[model samples]
Target: MSLPSTFDPSRALSLARETLDIEAQAVAAMALRLDQRFVAALELVLKSRGRVVVMGMGKSGHIGRKIAATLASTGTPAMFVHPAEASHGDLGMITADDVVLGISNSGESEELTAILPLIKRMGVPLLAITGRGDSTLGRHADVVLDASVEKEACPHNLAPTASTTAQLAMGDALAVALLDARGFKADDFARSHPGGSLGRKLLTHVSDVMRSGDAVPRVPREAGLMDLMREISAKGLGMSAIVDADNRVLGIFTDGDLRRLIERTGSSADLRALSARDVMHPNPRTVRAEALAVEAAGLMEASRITSVLVVDELGRLSGALNSNDLMRAKVI
Candidate 1:
């Protein structure tokens, strides 16, 4: 890396701070400006039978794409249609049932203005987020959200900086309000984003990751210590459930238990003589298979245990899972 001879670090830092201050003030001003118009916009979108069709040009076009995505993920059906594309055959994408949200910093993008009349003619309600309510886009809009910023963060006031920030803030406000009105929840968001970490945590259940049947380590109550140890080693769960003939869990034996037993009895104790019933801890913590994997994770953390046994409604041993299972499933 290298710096030019004219580079001044302090000047760069001062300008960066000023830019943030300007953008922050713009967003704050917008909040104070909200009124019945914003509410009307929300009602319009909520009442629509079709999607919210977002349209913009250039920098606004980029912001529109993001707003559309946010609305879609948060339970509102929305999509972005570039104004220039709408001028072409893409105008057909807008239906009478849809609500059109046009975004422009100056409210005077040539491509956007050219399509306003066409959108109005389609009988779709128009909503505008722009700096000038007197501008052509605003005049055609049924609801106008005043996103006007006093100035751009750029020193020359030529870049889209602060104005774009205000536009983004407006988009976020709409998405959040609409989500609340529609009763959209974290689970709904998770369904739209199944590949994300939050989706895995909310959607994965204990039954999906637990080891069951022959994969679960278990031994009869009368099993000797050697038999219990073999079951643990073979299943690789580091624990074995002591069950009755009917498969009801009687107790649990783990590596932690074995260590504690060794500490109490010392090396002189005859380990080979002990049976599963003699070594197991009774009334172990267990979770149902249908419970969320995160719940099992919570139980393990709260109890300071590494694994938990899964049981059916009748309290029979059904499965087993440990920290490793949660880790592999990315639920931890």
Candidate 2:
């Protein structure tokens, strides 16, 4: 067709949507075709003590990186090794206990094939994810997971679109299966991703972010309001726990309470005359020092408070955390 003088925006969008629909169907087709070979591949990876070395070339290499990341974050230790790099001595990273996952749309990437013999010689298990089950790479692999697609999303039917999507999804399936088999929990995932918000929610304990001991803003029940404000200012937690002689939390005096008290009594003389017990909000929210930081965040949000007292098993004050702590730790 000749080019139109003006562009047809709807036609261009329809073409893009058609491509996505084709790829989506290709992935859906894979679910029904998953067989025993997929199980065997997962078993090989899970049983290996060393990491999974994922390798590919061209577009396959991009997908390989994502697969490796997914595997590493989901209890399976994995890293991407380019086939070209492998031929240049990077192959030493692979160990006998590791599994080699080679991805190829045509099942015949020459760079990948060039290093397969050496990987095989090292006694490392070889797994192939490819569009062709009868290709040389598939035939040589110990286990093959077919990632075939009927057509490419490319208008010319040449680009690696649907094929790579299938491969990526298959890799995810393998990683999740290994994760379940290994009984990998959220805490385990948090350990690997400690720098992110998910890690803060799962791995950060109350003790990790809470203010401890004397560092906690606290005042005795009989202490004057000025003394309580001094403690709050020094600790900078926006609230002070009012404890008794035994150091057990009796009530909490917060900035909000202070504001309300000031509104009612027009003088600093009246505020100074008030004792901790006289101005405090009794039975303030508290959390155990061992609780998850995420739990603390929920308690704060539910009570519409900015801070909570961290207590021990016996209900004695151990530490304190406010909205600031949650923000700093990325738990919120």
Candidate 3:
């Protein structure tokens, strides 16, 4: 068969568009079919004391892994198991306290159906996500989630395109439902994803990255101009807090203030007369040590300041943090 040399690219684009439209319609149909079985499935998994054991074959198995990941990340504690490997002893991973989620488009995948009886015998609640409600796996399931699609997006009508997308979306629905049921908070997510930027924003506290003790770049209110500059250089926070004898912050001396002071004073003698109280910016921005790093970043941005003094509940200076610290913590 010779293909037409003058074939338009628009024809191929139209076909692709039609395929997606059909898939979207299929998913919409599935949503309309949702019933009490969905609720029962969620209850079964939510009541399980152990993990959600997800099992499937081929493309369904790939979708199962993603579903399991979403469940685990949202506090459901799920893990995917390949049905092909289950007969070889991986079935030991499932326990009576667990709920088994089996995904099979036809609901009759030989590998998946073969273990249905075993999962039943173990007293594990089996939830099947399938197109055919009368399939062997569905018949054995305690609850069935209808992930049926009218047809595949493949041109030949044989690939797992629309069905897989529906399954993925349904799996997300389950994960999100479970997340809401468990009251999963962003802090809980941060604990699980400590390496990501979201983790830094949620888990990082001001105390974790704040400059403390001698590194806070603090000086007494009576400190001389030269002494304040030395403290700023040694601390490298670009600002020094002027504190009282009790270590309570009274004012702040920043590099910006130093520049303005230099411009106003024509000579070293004029600059020498400037004490901490005389030149310091009084009532500078401050934050609590227990505040979020992101909050610190906000305070810096709103005040147009580079550094903030970290104070305790009693208003005594405890530490300091600059934009650099926020950058290092990935909070900015």
Candidate 4:
């Protein structure tokens, strides 16, 4: 689409700034009006044994869907149901245990108000988010939340601009209140979003990403430096763990250790004569397989190392992982 010949860059920028200012003020005004009514809405939703049935019309419906998603992700059971569809048999989705949350700018949206009586007859509590507390929807509501705005940000005062913003803010306010009331935590949020990065950081364990069994680089304490280097190179973990006959972790030797060893002994020294026990750093950083992968990353970062040895509760060498493994798993 081409811009109109009369389109003024300064005018467009001014309108954009004014729209944001109007929306910001609308939300701020709603915040000031919050009182016992807002509390009633929160308590109503919290006490319900069923989900929150959100309903709206037109632009409000679009906001309702987003609100429902936010509520569901934040530990609240909620879903959006189009108000217009309610009259078309979609009303069956609402249970008696559920709470009906209606959104409208005028509080008399035809599609939304038409079902207010049905919702009430079903013995379900109604929560209204609207501009007019005296309007039909608010009159039928068990709890009314005022989402009023002085005017629309639209130049003609016709579009649902600030009004819709207020409705969205009210929905977010309810979700956040209910989330805190239920003691929702970051881990709970991550569980709902398992495919997200937060889930990888919180749910992934060391055992889930670490190389185990023969794949782990390990050399007995009596092993020669040549064998130790071979294990490190073969495992490609940039390190090798030194263990005893019982496979209990004794120490770890990494590329850094090898570099410092060579630098200290000089090229003329007999590097072949060094044993695993003589070159390895004793009691190297180790993490339990059951621990979170993020915890292993923290250990490596704090110790200034690239890799860490995984150990069992008995301190036996079980697996190994490096920064690369964490990056692959997206836990770092």
- For model 3, give the RMSD to the true fold: 3.5
Cα deviation of 222 in candidate 3 (Å)? 3.2
**Poorly placed runs, candidate 4 (over 4 Å):** 1-3, 298-304
Ranking of all candidate structures by their lDDT, best first = 1, 4, 2, 3
Q: What would the per-residue lDDT of candidate 1 be over residues 130-190, giving only the tens digit for each residue?
A: 9999999999999999999999999999999999999999999999999999999888998
lDDT of 3 at 92: 94
Which candidate ranks first by lDDT, i.e. highest? 1
Winner of 1 and 3 under lDDT: 1
Error of 1 at 62 (Å): 0.5
| Clash tally for model 2 | 0
Worst lDDT 10-window in candidate 4: 230-239
For 172-236, candidate 4 gives per-residue lDDT tens digits of 98889999999999789889989989888988999999999899999999999999999888988
Model 3 score (lDDT): 0.90
Q: What C-alpha lDDT values do all the predictions have? A: 0.96, 0.91, 0.90, 0.92
Candidate 1 has what TM-score?
0.92
Query: Which 10-residue span in candidate 1 carries the lowest summed lDDT?
Result: 115-124
Candidate 2 stretches with Cα past 4 Å from truth are 1-8, 224-235, 261-275, 330-332
- Rank all candidate structures by their TM-score, best first, as comma-separated numbers: 1, 4, 3, 2
In every candidate, how many clashes are there?
0, 0, 0, 0
Candidate 1 Cα errors over 4 Å, as ranges: none
